[model samples]
Target chain A: MKPILEIQDLSVEVESKKVLHHVNLSIQKGEVHALMGRNGSGKTSLSYTLMGHPKYRVTSGRILLDGEDLAGMSPSDRAKRRLFLAFQNPVAVPGVTIASFLRTSIRSVRGDEVPAKEVRKLIREELAGLGISETFMSRFVNDGLSGGEKKRLETLQLRLLQPKVAILDETDSGLDVDALKAVTSRIESLRSPDRSFLLITHYQRMLEAIRPDVVHILMDGTIVKTGDASLAKEIDEQGFQSIHEASAQL
Target chain B: MSPYSTTTRSTRKNRIESLPIPSRKDENYRFTSLSNFNLQQLNPSIAHPPKTVEPAPEGFQLAACTYPGGLAIALESSSHEGLHLSPFEDAPEAIFQKHRAAFDLPQALDADLFANLSAGRCENELLIHVTEGKKITQPLFLRNFFPSTDQAFYSRTLIILEANAELELAQEFVWDGIESLIQPFACGLTQIVLGPGATLRFSTVQNWNPNTEHFSRTYSVLQEGSQLTLNEVHLGGLKNQTRHLTHFEGRNSQSLHTVTALAQNSQQMDFWIDAVHQGVGSRSDVEVRSIAQDKGQIVFNGKIRIEPTAPQTAAYQKNPCLILSEGAVIRTLPKLEIQTDDVQCAHGASISSVDEDQLYYLASRGIPENTARTMLIEAFKAPGLRGVSNPFTKSWLSKNLALTEEEQ
Candidate 1:
């Protein structure tokens, strides 16, 4: 059982200031890992670095996807290698329609053009599952969409792209209960033998439904605790401060 | 039988002869240089028509005296009743003589010296007139295929749309391998008269090879309640200068001017657009989007004027230029002159490279760098191109855009 996605001693910096420090994390194939962190805890920094965002500099350490190093590779090349990132704040490209962008991404990743008819059908079915109307397919990519709608649209991409490893950064935030449920069910549906996921979130509400196989608490740019699902529930009840105090006392 | 008559041609030719060659001192000539194009090399005030027509040439389908393909290919119009085609000599008296000052070339030509040169030297030009109340559904396409660029030439087109008449006019220029054959310059003038409540959608694609310098002028006057939409697409030219003027003369009339410029390699593009609101409650909107790559140079001069008596006038002008590389130059000026106290007017101009966030976002979605670049450029230009209501013209632009992408 080899780890499908691994980040070894990873540190990330943005604009000459270090935001992440020596973070070690790995998710084996078919396993779901939840990264819990407070604000400024560098959760997003780690995820973006993994996706090869040009703005985030990987100062040290290596990001491995299926035993291959991802550093120096472009974001698009990483995407072609089946590594996907669900942006927390999705970019709004005003003129690109959702369906066209999706089809283009599919063609770029799959190395084959998907017929327009098939693309429309898939978008219709996926959007329906997320309770979003098919009209969104005609709209610009995430342009003026509600926060909840942007999250669901991202989840839709997550499924359609069928990446080997998916890193979802704060995807569950801003989602109402029904939307959260829809997203959890979609996450469940995506459960497969070879796929892996790293879900980044702070609260335990999302984990209650998706039920992560492992939960890690990241604070001040480094992972300080790695535990089972019960640990997430304990932190949710006791809050992160008590654990911080307990760890400091150790 | 020529309605234009000999007197008017000589009168314009005299104007050209008297006016010294335009220089940087002329405000309208602004950033354009008088030396690079070498307009002086041309016969200062004469239009030289083709000596021989070589069966539509090697590539393009030459616009014949009459055509199943000439007008049909350019305008993409199916109707024929409202169609009028002539070689200047046979223009009708009522159309040519009735609106003596009604056409806009007279007033617009004063802005530049070359325009006067073109008018003075023009010969055997085409004059088109659309009758009142007839909706010409078929588009009118003027496919100008220069038989040979051995000498300098200038052509003229006069269009009059009567009240309630409708037409979509398109112009496409093609001279692929004839660049070296081009001597000094080639020019054309199109004057339009939009009758009260008439509607016209005009589009132009300027693609001239590197050898020929090109200049074009379009001046249109709209009557009361008339509607006008004009799209100027500049894609290829060695040195190109186009001046467009739209006068909103009628009360309650609306006009939109959209321009798209693509200047690549060492080519130069200068575009001047003016929107004049004279009628009460008239409104106008002007927008330009340009892309300059390699050593291409581009200039956009846009102005909106609200007359003293035209109250409640609303006007806006926006020009955005995208620079793709070093040595690319862009100069833009957006001006609003409002003599009326009660007016809403605003203008903006900016030159920038492709947004990094936009580039990264597309790239992260698995789009290759080349594809992303092409996509961004197309998207940046689409909002303006979508204003093109004529199906034929829009399709032609889309096909040409793809052709440009492949050329890159």
Candidate 2:
């Protein structure tokens, strides 16, 4: 079985500041990987760079999705290739209804128009699955939505788009325990032998709920340590300082 | 000779001379060169008047009030009653004279050669009267056709609504395919009076022939407690200039103005919007969006003014331009003038190319780069186009902005 995504020596720079040094990580098909890091540790930068954010320049290295070079592809193209980034702060596109936006996205990604009735049915099912009401589908995307609602909306898109590899940026933030549970269950349901996830987060609470197959501690742009899901529990109990000390000894 | 032409040419010189250019210092003309266009060159000429009065084109219809008498009587009475009942005809001549003076009417008039075929010809003007407490169910469609390249023609429209009346009007401009370039000018002054509690939705589609140069001016006045929404679409032209002005004169009046200009392949468009909040508690919102490609040039200027007496007035103006080609030029000026401390006024102007992140986001979704750029541009203009009330017009605009299958 081939890896779903591979990041080889990915060095990223933003605004002339080196945010990600020589970093490397990979996720095999159907695996859930957790990228844990402190504030300003380049976890989000790495995700954005992989998603081809204009500001996050890949100073050096390559990003491959299913053996296809994704360094120069656009976010939309990346999205078509089954790549999704549930932004920590989703942009508010005023005057665009959620239904219309999703319809456009589906058409652009699939290169074919989905009948309105069918799309509506699909959206309704996806919204229900994410614990969102049908009324939410008529409102503008991310406009005036509560933080939790926005996160669920992202999950709704994940379910609708069914991207092969989803890089969720801090989706656990701002979600209540119930919302977190729902989100975790949705992520768990999406887990399969062919689909993969690169969950970038700072807290271990979410990981405890949706246990990942592998946990990588990212610090200063590089993945300093990789281990089984126990690594998350160790970081939760001992904090990152102990990990830094242990790495120094190693 | 038609009465209009006989009187038009003889009085043309006097009218041009008597017309007053409101001083550039005037609050309305401030920040705009009101007299930049040379009006003297626009001499009234009837030598090549339209040879025939062509029938209305396809996809358009016109209907007027049905009187007990024959069509002639109905037409005559309608024209007489419309012209006389117009509040604009009763407005202080000083205001009309001011606009006439500042802008060269004849020169700015469309010079399309096809207009000559219908020269001295007059189409039956549709008279719409919304009585107090009356609401119109069907949108009135006014379509004008200039079928010949041999001459110039003129069309006049008058719309009046009584107090508490609600109406929606859609006006479309279409030119026949002329073998030669057409220079036609349509002088339209649509006067809408919202009696206290009245509301109106007015939309215009200016899709002239690509070989034609078109000019038009639309002025609207809102009475106290009345509301107005004006949507303008510009899709075709060699050289097109349009001026849309809205005045909120009654206390608590409100106005929303939106303009979308899509220029491609060396087309030049100048779109100007002027909104005046003159009554206390009056509010105005203006938005202009333009997409220019292939060395196209688009000029967009939006102004909002809050008078001193209009305390608690709120006004906002936004002009954003998307340039798809390196050589395309977009000049945007968004201005706000507030004389009352209690008023809220804000203005923003931006000229930017496509966003890389947005592009990448779309491309990664399997959409190519060019298709992504086109989609982003459409998204950028969608906000302004959403206000269009006519479904056909909205779909037309969508088709114009959609990415081709090959491109996708």
Candidate 3:
């Protein structure tokens, strides 16, 4: 089957500085791909470039979703095409409540096929499933929320949106051990044959729970290593330094 | 005859004559100027014809209604006892005495030029009084109508609640004539007195014609253990200036003041709030939010003072503004004065255009860019209306804010 998402030699720049150089990747339907990279390795640049952030310039290459070019599409338009990104640091909106935000996003993506009243009901249930208080629905979006709480709210959006290609950017960085387990469990529950996920992180801890089918190591704006799930275990045991040595020899 | 119409009028007119034209050089008027308003050419005696008063809505008992520049005053009959509402000209001697006392409280009338102008040439006055220890279940409604004409209009109102009394008031201003062809000016004053342990929820909605210039002053005095919440919304007028002053007079009194202004086109709006804490353990919260589009301009000046006598007082003042267009401007000035050592007082102001990151966040969730901008702009003003305690006031403001019924 054709890949659900493809990056054709994507080279990206930020403020006229090249961050990602001729990078290429592909993810088939119903597959989990883990992109591991150290700090300053352009992990976030790829995610932002995919979402059409104005600050991140795409110097070259193409991003395809089911064989369709996504270049020049607004983030909202890309979202309607079933692309979602969970940010490492979510922005806080002081007066917009979580329920209101989710409802609006759902309506925008779903195009009013789902009634607002029904969407509200679903939001309440999802919030409760995450062990968040019902009153959390009334609080401002991510305002005054703890790091763990922000991650949970992002997961809540993922469940509601059910996007075709979901990118998780450092979602496990701020979480505690217990929170990591709970969040990964939620992510594992949403796995299906029709959805694809790209989990981006530097640690193998989260990979142990979600168990990606394929793993890629990015270093200095290039993917130097690609292998099966065993590659992630090998890096976890010997650390990234071993991979650095092996890739240098390649 | 009332002394306010006879003796006070002559004195105020003299004061006005001596007062120089307010220029941008003055501290209070530094961000604004009155030169383009053409105050000298406008006539103050062009009266509006009388208008018929509509019946009161359910859950409200109308006390009285009056057209500002008209010669008629319509009094609605109410079956509720201990509640008195009437025109100032027809009020009994006792009510008149209370009005006189209320009108004397030190407020913006002390030095504000527009306030003095309103007091000197008020065309009519409304008086609302509730007996001591009486809690009126139904709110009192007052509506003031003005004709669309190239003239000046002035009005005044006085509200008095006796000890332990409770009342909610929703006051609205409406233009009653055809679409105006010429500029019009209006000046109004409202004085409120809350006795010991009394509570008052007051809201004022001003949506005058686009060709109108409005100056409104509301002064409130809170006594021992009394509570006051004031919500004001400004959405119209070519040039508008609003002054709100609340004095905490007795121990443990509390006050909350919220002001919201939305300006588009070439409209100019100035909102000023002053809260004086003179009583021990008193508290005050003042918030002002405004959004300006096109060439619109908005100015907010908020001040809170905690006197030596006001030990253990807590006060906060915040002003947040949004400028949606390149030509739009917003100026916010917050001042706090604390003479007491144990008092807690703080003030802050923030001015910015629509936040790009916030818009991107919403847009990333599938909301279009235009819709996201609108949503963020509306959300910025939600804090100003969150503290409203009166349902009628909340509903009135939500309607003007274009909030859906589900959102409210």
DockQ of each: 0.51, 0.38, 0.76
Q: Write the per-residue lDDT of candidate 1 for residues B244-304, one digit (tens) a residue.
A: 8888888978888888888888888888888888999888888888889999888888888
Write down the worst ten-residue block by lDDT for model 2 chain A: A108-117
Q: On a 0 to 100 scale, what is the lDDT of residue B55 in model 1?
A: 47
For each candidate in the order shown, give its overall lDDT on alpha carbons.
0.76, 0.67, 0.82
Native contacts matched by each model = 0.53, 0.48, 0.78
The sequence of per-residue lDDT tens digits that candidate 1 reaches over residues A209-232 is 877999999888988999999989
Candidate 3 CAPRI-style tier? medium
Model 1 residue B159 lDDT score: 78
Report the CA-based lDDT of candidate 2 relative to the real structure.
Answer: 0.67
Across residues B1-408, which tens digit of lDDT does each residue of candidate 2 receive? Answer: 123334433344344355454453432322223344444433223333233433322322233221111011112223322222222223334333433321122233233221221122223223345556777644555555555443343444445566787766666666666666435444343445566888888777777777555655565667889988777778876777666667788899998877888888878787777777789899888888888899788887777878777898888888887888998888877767777788888888888888665565445445567765666676687766556665655554455545222111
What tens-digit string does per-residue lDDT give for candidate 3 at A26-128? 9999999999988998998899889888888888899999899998999999999999999888999988888788888999998767786788788777877
Q: Looking at model 2, how many pairs of residues clash?
A: 47
Candidate closer to the true structure by DockQ (higher is better), 1 or 2: 1
Clashes per candidate (backbone, < 3 Å)? 9, 47, 0
lDDT of 3 by residue, B1-408 (tens): 556566666677777777776666664732445777665765465565554566655555555555555434344435566777765666677767755756542444667777777766775666788889999877777776777753677877888889999988877777774795667788888888999999998877788888788888888889999998887788888888888888998999998888888889989898878899999999998888888999998888888888999999999988888889999998888888888889888888888998888888898899999989878877887765766756666666777777644463
Candidate 3: lDDT of B381?
Answer: 74
Query: Pick by lDDT: which candidate is best?
Result: 3
